[model samples]
Target: MSIMRRFSFNHATAKFWDQREAVEACARTGSGIGLWREPVQEMGLEASAKLVKDAGVQVTSLCRAGFFTDPTQAAIDDNRKAIDEAAELGAPTLVLVSGGIPEGGTIDSAREGVKEALSVLAPYAGERGVTLSIEPLHPMFASDRCVVTTINEALDLAAPFPAGQVGVVVDTYHIWWDPQVWQGIARAGREGRIASFQFADWVTPLPAGVLTGRGQLGDGCVDFKRYLAEVDATGFTGPIEVELFNDALWARPGAEVFEETRAAFARVLE
Candidate 1:
């Protein structure tokens, strides 16, 4: 099969585009989609589910539902809702970004809070046929975006739970800098913890700020083929979502950006 057969487009790549239009494009190419919560909620869960189902588009994963550094009841409730939404959409994985350091708390304390939150949601997710995917952001995002910033850290957090109940997301943009990433990938594969695999290149920002400058493939320093080889070696054959967040891409028409992204992905895999 073509490597593009497993390609998935993340909605955040075109944050302002219409979800229906995006779904139509994915369906035409047999591509999958990584959906975010706000858009899904805006379109209404049932309507979004119906749209994808009717289009024969696969919902690869949900964008996120984890911000429980404090493990507040509110956070738990919201995540429960997200799990239900994933189930409703036929998304097997619910990506999670453990919230950053809480007020007056150290990174260590913040992580403990994530543990507490997971304890509450893991079983709930498992029962609903959803996997909570722990996505560790880069260390630069530690203070405000996510405290979990490494594959080892994400894997460690998932260890106590059943692999099916909780797993790690191997996102290139986040874990590419880890010296032991290969070993981490192998370990995650051995333990059945790689629930989601995503791609984005690291590039110097063009005044679009760091977070919004996830480079288009081949524009920056990521070696897509190597990442692909390592992941394939791990026996992971899931959708490889191209989740770029470039301000330039987002400014273009959704269909134009969609085609460009697909071509870029095809080039990288070639």
Candidate 2:
């Protein structure tokens, strides 16, 4: 049997493609995918599930499930549904973005919210055999996008959960600039908590919204090979998913972006 290469595409980049088309694109490239809930929901979960099954492509993860820093019971309940969707689609993990500070809230309060949210959802994720991967967005988004802004912060959040239930997503884009990153990666590996490793190049003067400005692999400051080597040393073998949220990439034809992304991913890792 041929060894599968280490690469996965984030469905968000294929914003133009309908659900089935996105799955087919991954299938044609013999690649895996990271799916987002909005598109999956719009396309119907069952329909998306069937398409991935038929196409024989792996759903590496479900893009998100956590955005309730002032987490109410309702937010916890919603994450359960996200877990169910991931299970139905055979996604091994659910990517979680610890939500931003609530109104009249401090960052400390938001951290408490993350703990509360995870406390409610982690057990449920474990029951379903789905790993919850907490992704720490860049500090630039600490106020509005995600509270967990460093791998250390994510690890701290995941530490309480058993390895099977919760782990940290070490996305290079968010953490490449962190001075304490090396220790964080090593500690995550030591604890067996390296859940879903991702890739995105780092560009300067981050774009507004701080969400859509992710650079294509090799187009920015990230040392891709260094990250690969570090993660590889951890003995955690998983797809290094390319998850660029760039508007320019999103505007291009899916096929064109896919081909370019695949090439960039390979080139950077090489």
Candidate 3:
């Protein structure tokens, strides 16, 4: 497939962009979208689903569900709800950020929590036709965002489940620095576990918030073309979602953000 044909704009890239407008823009561009739960809820599940469906926009994946570091019944329940939401929206994958170390818990213990939670939810997700995609954030986020810090670790967590039930997301912003990223991608492909693939550049001197540190395509050190070739070599031809977060970008108009992001993506990959 053509690169632009596989392009997807994640709503969080322009944090405050109106959902309908974003989806419409994606439709016009023949792109896909990665949707978040809050905006979907605010837009009402039915309405949000209709908006994408009417526009003929593909819902690439749901932003998140996990945070099951403790694996409490409540956490499991909430993730189940997220899975349901993903099903309703026709999202094939539900990205999971295993929450940080819980109170009185160590990182290792938190990882155990993720394993147990997946055992419970993976089957449910499989039954509903949604893949629970484990996302290993940069180690800086290990304590509070996700205990899984490497693609290998995430793969280990997903090992027990069928590829259709659980998989890993390869988000460049998070895993680009991993020494074994290429191996992990090849392994994921061999196992059919590449549930979702996302792009975001890693600019140096991260912002104070850290979370808003993602750079626009071509603005940083990440090699987007190389990443594309790596995944393509894995025989995966899925949508490549551009998910960047910048406070300044968020502060601007959404339509402008779309144009800038579009140009930036082409510059970086084409």
Candidate 4:
């Protein structure tokens, strides 16, 4: 028998392509997809949802939620809307990139804000049958993108929630360099917290904004087969998503990018 697995292409990987076309391509390739919020909103959530559904494409996750570092009511409200959006689209996971340091405070305070925000949002996500996947961005993004910068940190933050309610996203680009990555993966599996598993190889001399330097699947140093094995050992059977943020990819036609990414992802897995 074959080692059955599912692959998902995140919308960010198709930033160069039109959103609908991206989803269509993933569907045609018999893979799943992860949606981004802005494009979904711009295309109209209901319409986008219908498009994916009609294409017979599974939505592994919705790109984001939980930027509530300030822990303000507005932040909470926005997250709630995000949860609703995820639920509306039948996405099982809502990837959360915890907001960075606030203007007036320190990283510790921002973390505390994350705790408060999650405390408020977790129950709602749980009730709606959506998993909130807390993503630990790379340390390079520590100050502005996400304060949660390691799998361990993400797991610690998720420790308080129910297993199926809140979880951590394991994105190779962000956590690959960590010394305790294996331990973190083990812990997350033991706790049933690996909600989304994403791939984006690393590239040195990271770009200025540090957002567009993602390497293609097999072109970078990531040992994808090993990563997949670790995830498999955890008994987490969710789709493995490719989420590259490279500018070159965005300059190509969505179909070409999607095909190339899918091929690379499959090649590395083999």
Candidate 5:
């Protein structure tokens, strides 16, 4: 198959896009899609599942379900729900943004909480045929958005679980700056723990919050060709999901953004 055929558009890349429209675009293009929780809930899980099933679009992964920094029973319950949703949608992976340090808690404590959380959720996810993909966000977001800040860290956190139950997400935007990224990817692949592979470029002059500043593919300095080569060397032939959280992109229409992003993905890979 062509490289473009491996493209999967992540819904959060176009944050406000209607869920049905995003799935339809994937269907029409014979691409895969990654969905988020809010929109799935809004559309109703069964209806959303049926929609994708009828359209013949692959649900690559589900957006998120792992803010267990505080490690409450409620948090574990929610993660179980997320696993169920992924199974219903035919998504093999559920991307997890393990939340940052809780108020009054140290970062060390937060990391432990993630471990505890994973221990609780991994078995449930395995039973549902879903892999909980631990996403290590950029170090800049370590204090608030996500404490897991490197592919290595994510892999370590996933170590105690079966690869089929827990794995790591290799998002370029998050790990491109890591000097040992290639090593991390190889390790993840060697251990059979690569669950999701996402793309987004790194741009400077980050926004005030730094959350919506992800650069479009090829618009920034990420060496995607090198990334692809390294990842492909590891035998990962799955969907390469493009996920850009750019304020400028979100301001435009979803259809336009989808086309532009898809074109960008093709250009970068080519």
Candidate 6:
């Protein structure tokens, strides 16, 4: 198969794109797609599932299902629902962005909360044949977006559970700045915890919130070839999802963005 066969387009790259059009684009290109819960729900779960299934497209992963830094019952219930949705959509992994510190809580406390929440949800996800993928966002967002800021930390949180039930996401955008990234990737591979592999270049001059500033492949400082080599050395031959959150890309037509992003992926990998 061609290397492009392993490319999966993440819907958030074009935040404003219509769900059906995204799926159709993926279908046309014979690529997989990573979906978000909100759009999936808005388009109706069963309908969304049918759309992909009929189009012969794969659901690389479900965007996210974790935010239980506080570990409340409601949070647990919601994650269970997310797992159910992943199963319905034939997504093997459900990404988890462990929420940041809650009010009156320290980062340490939030970390503990994530551990407790996973203890409750891991078994449920396992039963449904879905892997809970912990995604470590950039450290800049550690205070408000995601407390999990390193692959090692995510691996540590996942260590307590079975590799099949709990795993880590290796997104270059979030980890390229880490000095020990290569070591972390090897360790994750050794532990059999690499559930998802995503790509998003890191650009400077981050925006105010720093949420929608993800750079396109080859436009930023990320060394895609190096990342690919390291990940391949780990024996990880899974789909590589390109998940950019760029404001400029969002403003353009979805089809145009998709084609450009796809070409960029190929160029960088080449």
For lDDT, the strongest prediction is: 6
lDDT of each: 0.93, 0.88, 0.93, 0.89, 0.93, 0.94
Provide TM-scores for the models.
0.98, 0.96, 0.98, 0.97, 0.98, 0.98
Encode model 5's per-residue lDDT on 1-270: one tens digit a residue: 688889999998889999999999999999999999899999999999999999999999998899899999999999899999999999999999999889999999999999999998999899999999999999988988799999999999999999999999999999999999999999999999989999999877776747888999998889999999999999999999999888899999999999999999989988
Query: Model 3 compared with the native: what TM-score?
Result: 0.98
lDDT of 4 by residue, 94-205 (tens): 9999999999979999999999999989999999999999999989788887999999999999999997889999999999999999999999999999999999998766
**Where does candidate 2 clash, by residue pair?**
none
Pairs of residues at least 3 apart in sequence or in different chains that clash in candidate 6: none
- TM-score quality measure for candidate 2: 0.96
lDDT of 6 at 198: 97
Model 6, range 19-110, lDDT digits (tens) per residue?
99999999999999999999999999999999999999999999888989998888899999999999999999999999989999999999
**Per-residue CA lDDT of candidate 2, range 42-67, in tens?**
88999889989999999999988899
The per-residue C-alpha lDDT of model 4 at residue 31 equals: 84
Candidate 1 has which clashing residue pairs, if any?
none
What range of 10 consecutive residues in model 5 has the weakest lDDT sum? 202-211
* TM-score of candidate 6 to 2 decimals: 0.98
- Model 6: C-alpha RMSD to truth? 0.9
lDDT per residue for candidate 3 within 1-270, as digits (tens), equals 456888899999888999999999999989899999999999999999999999999999999788999999999999999999999999999999999999999988999999999999999999999999999899999999899998889999999999999999999999999999999999998989999999999998878878998999988899988999999999999998999888989999999998898888888887
TM-score of predicted structure 4: 0.97
Off by over 4 Å in 1: 205-208
Higher-scoring candidate on lDDT, 5 or 6? 6
* lDDT (tens digit, per residue) of candidate 1 on 127-205: 9999999999999999998999989889999998999999999999988889988899999999999999999989865
Q: Report how far residue 221 has shifted in candidate 2, in Å.
A: 0.3
